[model samples]
Target: MIQKGSTLPEADFSQLKNGEMTNPKTNDLFGGKRVLLFAVPGAFTPTCSHAHLPGYVALADKIKAKGIDSIVCLAVNDAFVMDAWGKAHNADAIEMIGDGSAEFTKAIGLDMDTSVFGGIRSLRYAMIVNDCRVEMLNIEDPGRFEVSDAETMLKAL
Candidate 1:
């Protein structure tokens, strides 16, 4: 898995912006910026939709107040689903990032195979990245959601 002080790997991601699909490279999102990034196993899952993404959406303003240039929510779903999920939650302040093929998740060593459940998906986690380097990492245990929540990350900041 990725660790503190390690720079993010090069990868491509997609997001829905202005009703259009935008392809963004890693540098475009993380370079020269302090970003609060959190990942969910999949979009619209029980915990993710009810808690994880909502927490970040609620706390986004406060998180950005602490010098974070942007707040991002990542999932293994396609950009269309991600965009719809964001809209469902009214997450206008958060960037809904889609890693459709688990490319970025695998590169960071956070991908997990859930077999019949969902195939390949990212583990739930949150991190603080500054200029492409990880400043802090909070990864959750399997079937658990503790350290990676928005409140914990807010307190840490």
Candidate 2:
């Protein structure tokens, strides 16, 4: 798990742009701004689709209002899956990001293999990072959920 007040690991990935995709790194995206980033195991899985992503989507506007420059949603899935999932969920408020290869998630020390999935993946987590530094982190407890929600993150901010 990532610790509070630590620097967030950098990630470079593509985002949907004009129906295509844009290549950008973590520094480029949140360079001098506040960022709220969340990660899920996959793009369209049950917990992610029904709960995690929606929570961030529903709070994107509010998160921005609280001075967040961008609300980024990341997954290990490819750009197509991430983009498609975002479109399907009406995730216009936040930026849909594709980690594709899980490089960023592992760098941040949030990688785990949920025995159920039988493969490496990013744990369900969320964090508020400023200038690439972590100001707050809300990593879920294994398979149990206690934090890592918009409401909790908003409160921290």
Candidate 3:
């Protein structure tokens, strides 16, 4: 499992923007920034589609109020899928990423054997990564959603 104070996975994924792509590395992604990253099992699913994303949405201003530089929503999905979900949800304040291959998830040891639901899934978790090292983490129990909420991370921040 991923722990607090660990460097994020060094993986690169294609980010689509304006029909173009840029494959950015993990190091560059969190370089010198205070980032709030939360992961859900799937994009556009029940809990994530509703409560989880909304928590970030509702408190977008509040989260930023704490001096955080960015709030990101990641999933074990692809960049295209992630982008689509972002548009659908109107997550203008949250950065959405699709880790379709779970490269980042596995590198950080956050992968769960949830093939029972079809392939790997990310544990519901949130982390405050400062300039790449995790400062704090909140991991939720499987099939339960609580710890990773934006408010919890906000308090930790």
- lDDT agreement with native, every candidate: 0.95, 0.83, 0.83
Q: Considering summed lDDT, which 10 consecutive residues are worst modelled in model 3? A: 13-22
lDDT tens readout by residue for model 1, 67-146: 99999999998999999999999999999999999999999999999889989999999999999999999999999999
By lDDT, who's the top model here?
1
| Per-prediction TM-score | 0.98, 0.91, 0.93
Q: Which pairs clash inside model 3? A: 77-100
Q: State residue 74's C-alpha deviation in candidate 3, in Å.
A: 0.9
Candidate 1 vs candidate 2: the TM-score winner is 1
* 20-63: candidate 2 lDDT, tens digit per residue: 77878878877788899888888888888888888888888888
RMSD vs true structure, all candidates: 0.6, 1.6, 1.4
Q: Which candidate order results from sorting by lDDT in descending order?
A: 1, 3, 2
Q: Given candidate 3, what's the lDDT at residue 116? A: 70
| Model 3 CA lDDT for position 83 | 80
The list of candidate 3 runs beyond 4 A from truth reads none
Which numbered prediction scores highest in TM-score against the true structure?
1
